[model samples]
Target: MDRRNFLRTMGTAAAVAAVSSTELGAVTLGKDKKKKAPAAETGLRVRFLGTGAADWKGPDDRGEYRRLSSVLLDNRILIDFTPTDADMLPEGCKPECIFYTHSHADHYNPEALLNLGVPTAYLGKTWISKAWKGFADASAKTGVPVPEIVPLAIGETVVCGDIAITALPANHAIDATEQALIYLIEKGPTRILYATDTGGIMGVAARIAGIDPHVKKGTPITGLIMEATMGMGDKGDEDYRLFTHSSVNTVHRTVKMLLRRERLLLKDGESVYLTHLARTLHPTQAELDANLPAPLKAAYDGLEVVF
Candidate 1:
């Protein structure tokens, strides 16, 4: 389908459940059950189901095991999926669709997609053909029907119910022919940049994020969920993952740059959460949270935030 017609069909097909006006604040799920600063009743809700990188083996220091990376938005849309996700999915969560960042095994799982039975799945246009074949093979092996696949190029935006998602080029790569991606999510006045599995923001993504004043600027981002795959301090500078992943130092520098450019908005508490943490590299979640600068916190599995 053409872009205009494609968008219209998706917007109607994936509209979320009606939002309630009740003032339910954000709360992280776990033994501690810490609550965040109160948010507006109509704020965008993001729940982290998994926060680990490709090396998903480890209990950290606190005996907490993070599955592969994935998130549920407003409890209706999912960002990435993995087989392990079934272990931690919130009760009553019926995700309408999924938006994948890339075709990495750690980020995308065809089995989970088939099992979950979401109606549609969207991803970067560069590798959609390969994805279609993969989905078809999976459908043939199993009895379930394949979810409809939608190809989205960088700089393209689609409306799904009350949310608007824009695809942006990521600095990471799986092969010479593929285009990895990050996402820009908009709901009402709340704008969030969900960047992972990529190096620091650069190229078209920088222009879209308003990092360069010379380029046409978009709306300021009200919140951010970025990856810090490398460990604390300056370890990422000399590590091999520096090219395709973010480090603690990289996140700090990027946040400072965004603040200076007035491109990012900070909330009262923890406006930014670092995900895709490497289990072998990082310390316990509490220690990580303690070391991060104010408003920039480490995200643990099952954490919830309303922006």
Candidate 2:
């Protein structure tokens, strides 16, 4: 089917499901009843800056909007710098470090990072030269000093304040020379797996599953922030598969693999959130909540979670 036809069909199904069901918010693993606590009081907090895929058009008058994907960690660390405008950032927020998944324009905006003035930024080892070029171009255009750029290797861990971050290899940008990274962040007892902008977890799942042995045995993952760019589309779609982004099928498969491998052990109250939404492929925020199972709802901008 053509893109337009596919989207129209999906939208219809989503609307139908939404009208018939009612369940919203983040998806949690297992089943239990516990009061949801504020992220500020919790050890780790994550706020999604933008939840749209690269193809996402800007917001419209009807309030259907999806910005490029990015997340703020405890308002101190930023995962990606896309759509990095003053309004997108939290008030009084200053990140100590910004982590880049790749050099994709939607994930990394040099001009935006220049304005933020973060002290340090991390990128894949293969991205240093490309990043330098971007920084140089931005500096010439904006007259902002270049921030320090650190190269990250797969499986290498870097300590940023209280958070221990490890960059894992991802299966993305196969045609490009630059590599992609998925982050594993840990603070106190809270551990979060931040995976986005990747097609599948096949190459990286084992490494992720092995992370538990490196930390305390019983320290389950406090949260999972994953990408669902393709939404509930068929995996056989050529355009979707070619882009190396996740669909509902791949996301579920990855989650199940993690659970079976004991890589991601969720405690009673932990939750899973799907971000990087593609408007054409997925339903609206409310419709998505109504359609998806518990602990697997779509994430929206300004949605904050603490674990």
Candidate 3:
């Protein structure tokens, strides 16, 4: 009904609000993980948990929750926590580490955290200039002593125990008020950059694929998870959605720029995964695959990959 009440209610359960609201909330992702999903079956696993471009729902209404926009990494690291993220965290996938590139309706999963305790002791995404203030506000309210916001710059690293994360700037929205963050995660030979809820990176995205002076230096792209949100055109044209969000061709351009021309360092065999699809373009997975560049696939809910 109200902001405070809305936040409080979301803290209760994934479907608590849906039951009361006319427009259903997110679908529910079971809390129980099926299997450990061995490397062979999982293959650098990355579960989409909800792949809708903007609106979210339970996949198939099977009671499985789709998120606004979020990615659970290695079953612990969280790229973003939309309300649906709570529904996406199928059992055995509760995240221990959380990283927010920016604070937005979909990016900030306050309710998701309430469903699973807020990760006050992890890499938090907050303002670069007002880091301490953000931490204090969180602490003041949640009473879950906030962790260091780790004010991260485009190339700076946010180390969590053994994991190293880098935050990059991106234009978050078309309306042009909110700023967003793109993240680069590294642990040994595997490196991942998570970009969502924003237009495709234009300039530095190519450089990001190149050698980084701070990181392992020349690590090539082993795994990449991008967004193919506007795969379909607007108003059901199947070709118009291209202008608003990145699509198959857009991804091809990105890969060509990052991998083909730059010759950026990458492992011999790397898999690039794309998420955030247009509901209108419910293309067969095969059809979606045929359009992407080499080693790229559209992301789906509950897709899991190991770095």
Candidate 4:
């Protein structure tokens, strides 16, 4: 609802960015296996079900299928929806909630939304307007009423089950060519940032003020899911990209802005998962993987991760 109320609802924060606190952090590596525990005690199980998005090949491409970025947390809560081949769906997989990071065709595919009966949230104005305009067409094919369109205001938080999700205005053109959204998702003691469709990090640091500046990081966020659409090296030259998207170098600089400034954190072995890739960009999965300091991995469709 309102900003004040929303922050209160999150209960606690992870300015320190630690695990064993957020939904994503519930994931235990091979050795952490408790003397063994029950499913409930383990917490929500998140899995990467797909790693694909529209134009994975290019603008003209539809879906030849190598990857489509989509994640199913405990078989519900889809991070981004893309048109994916039915064969790629994980066995017995079904999502209950869909959170759109932006309004790009790659992130919100009309075909994919057609089959889902669950409600979805649009965290940005660009995405809200685009989806609302197409509501009629999507409803007709699905035989389901248009989804309950929840309009999220910038800096507002919503409770999804046990998770508290907040939207931060992401940098993307609101013009006809594109519409977009980015998110900061939190649960219990963990905080997770889902940022996509960014071109630079300077403005992002200024807009992400909702994150309480005092909270220690590792205590809250167990993980970060960011974009690396561009590659390494100096990005000071391009005027177009600077205005609309972030390159790998920009992403790195942004990360430093947060972690170094204590806005986010990195545990001794904790990690950062990169998703929503643009293959045409300079940062290839190999490049991001090989160059990142540590605990970083390329996110693909169907890839599930813990905070």
lDDT (Cα) of model 1? 0.78
* Tens-digit lDDT track of model 2 for 1-307: 7533543444354334433432221211110113222232246778888888877767755578878889887666789976533467877676656889888888899888888877567888887998999998998998998876778777766654355677887777734677888888776667788889877764454345354333444334657788888777464234445467887666776676566656677777455788887777777788887876555768888888876
How would you encode candidate 3's per-residue C-alpha lDDT over 226-267 as one tens digit per residue? 777666334323454444456655665666656753334456
Which pairs clash in the backbone of model 1? none
Number of backbone clashes in candidate 4: 42
- Taken over the whole model, the C-alpha lDDT of each candidate is 0.78, 0.70, 0.53, 0.55
TM-score of 2: 0.79
Could you say which candidate leads in TM-score?
1
Preferred candidate (lDDT higher): 2 or 3: 2
Q: Which of 1 and 2 is ahead in TM-score? A: 1
TM-score of each: 0.87, 0.79, 0.65, 0.71
Order the candidate numbers by lDDT, best to worst. 1, 2, 4, 3
